[model samples]
Target: MATFQIEGGHQLKGEITPQGAKNEALQILCAVLLTDEEVHISNVPDIRDVNKLIEILGNLGVKIQKLGKGNYSFKSDELNLEYLESQQFKDEGSSLRGSIMIVGPLLGRFGKGYIPRPGGDKIGRRRLDTHFGGFIKLGADFRYNKEERFYGVEAPKGLKGADMLLEEASVTGTANIIMAAVLAKGKTTIYNAACEPYIQQLCKMMVAMGANINGIGSNLLHIEGVDKLSGCDHSVLPDMIEIGSWIGLAAMTKSELTIKNVSWNDLGIIPETFRKLGITVEKRKDDIYIPAHTNGYEVASFIDGSIMNISDAPWPGFTPDLLSIMLVVATQARGSVLIHQKMFESRLFFVDKLIDMGAKIILCDPHRATVIGHDFQSQLKATTMTSPDIRAGISLLIAALSAKGTSTIHNIEQIDRGYENIDTRLRAIGAKITRFD
Candidate 1:
């Protein structure tokens, strides 16, 4: 296990560039399986989860070549399909939740795909029903091994498209279905689909690869089947989650930081959501400039004078991934706000650690929390903690940076799974964080 020992109450300066989107990288990496041609991808984040997926690809016989930093070429010309049924694959595949996506492209091209029960952050119940449900709608037979905890989907005659109204606008689910639909026999219509930038990027990449996809940024997606898809070069957008994290870090520590080339238009509701907590999110060309919060920020109330309620919904709404960061940022703000983590029940549990640090938070339930900002009247006392998930891990890191003394955060692997070289990057910006393996 790796740990981070952070010296708190330090101001960070200089600019930080957000890495390529982790979520998008997961989807795009899987899309490589849809074609046998070489797909060159640049701006890939060097993170644990993405690297694990790339490793899984190599194990499955995808030809992978490193082009440069955050650049790689993948060709799935001679996949070892038999590996999908191996014990080695089962152990490797189960380690990443993103591995579920491989089933779609595999079933699309090779008539079969199987995956062991995938693993990821134990934030809450993350079901695989949506992914499998879409496959079943696309004329694939689904089977579940109760004893082995494995899933299998096969389409002997190839897939045939059908209209599907997704139960929820699950991002990965939508991506999985689109990959399969692109190779189906006819047009497929998906309503109530996830329209997050990651999904839109996946759609755009598929289009560039000769797949017919419409509705790039809407809930309704139409994909026309193609006999074969040729590979094309694609670059991932900067990770919005990381950008949001930097914004929160700047505010909590009263640091003036510039986040460069953030792909402003794709950020959707992120900047504005941060601004709701009274943080200054300035637009400088394509970058976001967050000035130090010398005067603590105040939470904005509703027009009718009710408390501000920030919640996550489908895209174009506040992202659930940043709610942890928001909650921590609110700890020192001038007023109170309610954080509603609607999608996952257990994500807010990390607030207990903040409470130990003297932040005034009321964990109303598994899904909600009310934070009464100290307005910097009281500084959080440093304490030992453990990271629970990727987002929460970064959130705790930000809190530790702004706390009164040194703090220890164990299980930093959770943070590394999403953020690349986080300690080194934070150090460059003047953050005093040390890593111990």
Candidate 2:
């Protein structure tokens, strides 16, 4: 396992650019399977989860070539369909949660898709019912092997589109269904779909590839099935989650940092949410300039003097991925705020580590936490900790950077799964972080 040794209380200064969106990369990469022609992709993040999915595609006989840094070309003309049933595939596919997306494109193009139970962060119960349910509604036959924990979907007659009202606006679920519907036989209407930037990017890419799709930035989507799709070049937007993390890091460490080319328009509620916590998020052209919080930040209260409550919802709302970073940043703020993590039940459990670091936090339940800011009056005492998930791992790293002394964090592989070259990036901005394998 890899670990990070961090020396705290250092002010970071410099410009850092956020990598390509990880969530979008996962979905967009899978869409390449829908066409037999070459698709060129730029700004792909070199992270663990994305790399694993790329490797899975290669193992399935997709001709992949590296063009340059953060650029690749994929052609799925002659895929090895038999490889999908091999034991090696089961082992490889089960290691990545994003691998579930490949099933939709495979089932749409090849009429059959099988996947072992996918694995990812142990945050909470991440059900696969939405993905399979959308497939079943589109006329695919679903089968599961309980003993082996495997899932398969097949449509020998090819998929036929149908209207679907999703139980929840699940992002990955919506992406999976959209991929399948692009090649279906009729028009497919999806209501209550996830319209996050990642989903919109996927929709836009599919449209560029000759799939008729409308409603790019709304909860309702309409896709018209086509005979086939042609590949096109696409570029992923900068990761909003990483931008939010950097904003929080700048506030907590009292650092003046400039996050370059952040795709400011795509960041729906992220900047305003941080501003509500009294952190200055200035928009300079396409960049975000976060000045050092020399006097510390203050949590904003409601108009009626009620405590500020921040929660996650569907698109255009606060993202659940950044709630961990928000919670960590609040530890040094001037007032109190309530963080409600509605999507995942167990994500807030990592607050115990912060409590040990001398932060005043109340874990109200599995889904909520109340933080009383220290106002920088008393610095967090450094302590050793273990990363729980990707978000929580980065949250801990931020906390360590703002703490009083040195801190050691184990299980940094969880951190590397999302952020691209995180330690090296931090080092570039004058952070004191060391890696140990």
Candidate 3:
């Protein structure tokens, strides 16, 4: 395992480009299994999850070649779909939740899909029953192997579209069923789907590949099942989640940064939410950059001119993934704000570390916390800490980077699951951080 030893209180200054979206890349990579053609993807993030997914795909007989760093060409056009039992599949599949995406594509094209229990952030009980239920609605049968902890679903007649009302608008669940719907027979309507930017990109990509899809931005998706799909080249969108992290990092460290190639359109209310926390965001053409030397941020009032709590909800709302970073950033803001993480129950539990850093936070319950900002600042007091999850791990890095002294973050592999080359990139921006095995 690798740990990050960081010297704090230095500004993370300079201009840097954000990597492609991890969430989007995961889904798009699996879409490769839908067809047997050359599908080139650019701006790929060099991270553990993507590499793991590549290993899984390679095990599935998908040929992948690296043209250069951050660029690759992959072809599953002639994939030996029956060879799904490669050992690499189980090894790599065990470490990433994105591994579950293969189930839909493999089921649609090869008539069967086998996947082991995928791993991700242990923030709480991450359920796959929603995903498997979606698969059942799309005409596939699932049986669990208790010993192996893997699932095998076979769809010999190919998937036939059916009306599905998701139990919850699970983001991964929405992506899984959407992929399966593309090659199914007849029209498929999915209501209460998670229409986050990643899901929209999946639909748009499928549309480009001859899959008929409607309602790109809404929670209700209409996909007309097509017999086949061809390959196309696409550049993954810049990660807005990373953009949020940088925004918080810049504010917390009192630094200036210009994040180039930022997808402003996809940012939605992200910039506004950061602005609410009193961070200054400057937009230039395609880039949404942050200004230098931020003072303490302030709580923004609501539309009815009343104080409002910042919380996560479905799409077109605050993203639950960024809630942890937002809460940490709030500790540096001028006033108090409630970070309501409605999606996951235990995500708010990590705030105790912030309290240890002299942050005033009250964990009301599993889903909510009240944070009073700017009133407390302490010497980050060089401590050895274990990373809990991807979002929280990065947030800890930001906190440590803003502290007065040295901080060593153990198990940086959790951070790597999402952020790409984080230490190197932070160093480029004047942060003193080094990684060691």
lDDT of 1 at 401: 99
How do all models score by TM-score? 0.99, 0.99, 0.95
Q: What is the lDDT of residue 130 in candidate 2?
A: 91
Each candidate structure's count of clashing pairs: 0, 0, 2
Give all candidates' CA lDDT scores. Answer: 0.96, 0.95, 0.85
Q: lDDT tens string, model 2, 266-347?
A: 9998999999999999999999999989999999999999999999988899999999999999999999999999999999
Pairs of residues clashing in candidate 2: none
Q: Name the TM-score of candidate 1.
A: 0.99
**lDDT at 298 for candidate 3?**
71
Q: Higher-lDDT candidate among 2 and 3? A: 2
**Model 1 agreement with the true structure over 88-136: per-residue lDDT tens digits:** 9999999999999999999998888999999999889998888999999
Candidate 2 local distance difference test against the native: 0.95
**Deviation from native of the Cα of residue 74 in model 2, angstroms:** 0.3
